[model samples]
Target: MSDSPHSTDGDTSRATLARVAEQAAVSMSTVSKVLNGRPGVAAETRARVETLLSEVGYTRRGAVVPGAPLIEIVFSELDNEWAMELIRGAGATAKLNGMGLIVTQSGTRHAPDPEWIDEVISRQPFGIILVMSDLPPANKDRLRRLQIPFVLVDPSGNPAPDVPSVAAANWDGGLQATNHLIALGHRRIGVIAGPHDVMCARARVSGYRAALESAGLPVDDDLVQPGDFHIEGGLVGGTALLESRDRPTAVFATNDLQAIGVYQAARALNLRVPEDVSIVGFDDLQFSNFSSPPLTTVHNPLYEMAREAARILLDIRAGSPVGTGRRELGTSLVVRESSVGPA
Candidate 1:
């Protein structure tokens, strides 16, 4: 008599689960709880079960429902046009794939809230799109155990090497902005940099420095002022640079909001834009074009980045071989009226 195929599959499933439980030193119920993402299992036991599951390539059976699949996109905050662009891009892709999108604002720029992972596991969405740089290792392991895929958009800092991410060409944007100013004969250039700790910020600043060096210009520490990717930081940094004894004729704000702040700073000091101080900003946001004298800026491709991230997540769901490395979109310089030959 031949063994039934159903019997063989059932036996194999049982054996695998039992082996996982034995190795984790937990009861079958405990293993089930960990697999289901229930609250009763002890943290340590849950971790052990998750690790063993990953090792054995055990995925929860039938976790994804047949209809009403969703793709969750989480953000640290959604106050600016930057977030809007990302949402538009990802939402459009999700719609085309016949999936609904769930947008959430939870935790900080670095990682999502602790409880967010449990909720996600329970929901069992098709995939996740996180606009954060760092994800906790435990959360990553849990997602892997359940076979839920995720991709990062514009990661805040340096994420793990294996995490899939999409971002703009910050270094090139910085270099382009600086080189554009240099081409206009502005030798003494000032840069209002973003937060020092952010990876994109660091890369942009480095590009600025590289441009100056390539032009045989000294990298003056005093000319590089700190910003917070906000208007206030630009206002403060721009004011200080403008008030210096040897102020730079051109200023590059790391972001559009800071550029607006720079505009304000120049106005308060009765300095005419371009005529008094040439300005360049990043992230060619919509409002940047409406600013007086129209802001010259770098196009950061936020929409494209988000679209690519959504595609990557979908590819993971389809079992396609999307690599773990970052997919960087290009950035270009959009010169309007803000930048000009230095007076």
Candidate 2:
């Protein structure tokens, strides 16, 4: 057989594979095992082979292999309603396109575990949708070499530029929420912000500050409290703000869960909703509407973002060009009974 390199239909060349195997000091059979996602290879050996494969730019056929009609969705955890909304959205889209959905929970917000990519290669799904999760460079290289497409549903608001992603307009949501409070004749507004490390949280805080400044109100540093996007964070932050000698008439919690915590804090302090202190929250979660004196919050459009991310992944899989590979959905304010004009 001729050793001259050539590619047909985007499949890796045989000569190139031979070179990769030689450099890794492995036989062609061992390389084939790694390429096919078969067992019997040592972990270190597999990683070395994968790195070499990536270095040589070995890519599989672009077309999906026969019998693998699956689209996988990855999340850090599945305990909350947020994950459920995303699953529903992506699952619906996948079914409509004649594919099954696979849900995987692995790793933290930064990236998935090292072995997760190997499992994915074995499955060889049609595409992948990652919600609030990222992949390391080696894993990314493996996916590229396999011609598998992936998209991120990034509520965190920080996504890699080269990858396709869909995110909500978090800053705009924050601005709208704060503006609503100001329009209700509130002179002092407090914000319970999410973790400072997250881009979405920082963007929301910036928006709140902008709204206060634009409305000719002072941006009091004391009114800005740290949170963790959870009820406990909200409770702690809300308690601190409410206990102050000169407390804010209105408060904005970065997320719905935090807002609920604020409610608990207010109740413990013997305050009535929207009477003693008006409140607003972000995310517009389903439970937000069921709270005593329903929550006035921002509609985050999590379901829509998931659907769009799945669509983009499918489009990439179909060999279509996606310009910029980034989409930001708009947010709207949902007025409920929880916020009112300060007395």
Candidate 3:
């Protein structure tokens, strides 16, 4: 004999359409019609059953629901105060736009991890903000494959053709700082540059050299040293520069942390700032103004840069094309007692 429509062949224990119908408080035929996507079931009945299916954790074969998209912010380093400030600015903007932020760390190794890109893609974030040092071609390709929108903050080299970026006017700031020292009659000027691989460091070095060349002064190789954008590196670099017989009348360190290191080195050497050797630094950090003689440095809007980056990411997520892929913010020279007429 033929089996009943709601029954399986001799398997009464198995759940069939009738069981689902009973649990959903609907007729067996109505459940059958809805399950088959037929035209007879009422819209309200269909919705009720669907809700029950979800609540009961039913997984229909070959079914998927689009998830909520998110945004990811990737940073190269998280230990520094500057990094913290950037996160605060980005976080504020993200919150304002009602978008979630997925913060990830890309180590200081050779390059960012391709696994990170894959993980980001798996999460299906609406966009990404790269606060990393520099991305290699492999990672870039992975990002391309995922088709995820991204913006870069303080990126190296020129902005990628399709990706938007925001950065400070580092080169111009360097020139301003160097020219300020030149105006003070500092013929023998020294520079403690950040790591060579860093784009900002390279740009500042270029600006410093340009200023010297523009002033008809020879660029002295002995007066320039490599600093790792750290206080200890600055201390070592400063000590080496100060110990030279032809010591510089003025010194320019890449950042305020380095500038503080310069101060410590000078104190050890019994050299009074501005009186014996004028000193200037970049990035007017919080403590720069509280130093012994108050550091004279270049003021770049770091928080503003981060905020703009977040805004750009939000716009991208909103399906708006960024008019310009690159934004370069300005910088100003902050004059203070730490720098004065060359002794």
Per-candidate TM equals 0.87, 0.87, 0.73
Tell me each candidate's RMSD, in Å, in order.
5.0, 5.1, 12.7
In angstroms, how far off is 281's CA in candidate 1?
Answer: 0.5
RMSD of 3: 12.7
Question: Candidate 2: worst 10 consecutive residues by lDDT?
Answer: 1-10
Over the stretch 1-343, how does candidate 3's per-residue lDDT look in tens digits? Answer: 1232322343432244456577879987776555334555565676565455444433221111111235677887777767777777877787776666778887542355655744664455656778753466655644443344667787443455555779888899999999999998889889999977777878887889999999999998998988988898779999999989989988899788889999988999999987998999998887889999999999877788888887886675466778646788888999998998975
1 or 2, which is superior by lDDT? 1
Model 3 segments beyond 4 Å from truth? 1-70, 133-147, 155-162
Worst 10 residues of 3 by lDDT: 59-68
Candidate 1 per-residue C-alpha lDDT over 179-199 given as tens digits, one digit per residue, 9 for 90 to 100: 999999999999998886788
What candidate 1 gets wrong by more than 4 Å, as runs, is: 1-36, 47-61, 65-68
**Model 1: colliding residue pairs:** 133-156
List the lowest-lDDT window of 10 residues for candidate 1: 1-10
Pairs of colliding residues, candidate 3: none
Rank by TM-score, highest first.
Answer: 1, 2, 3
The lDDT of each candidate is 0.85, 0.84, 0.73
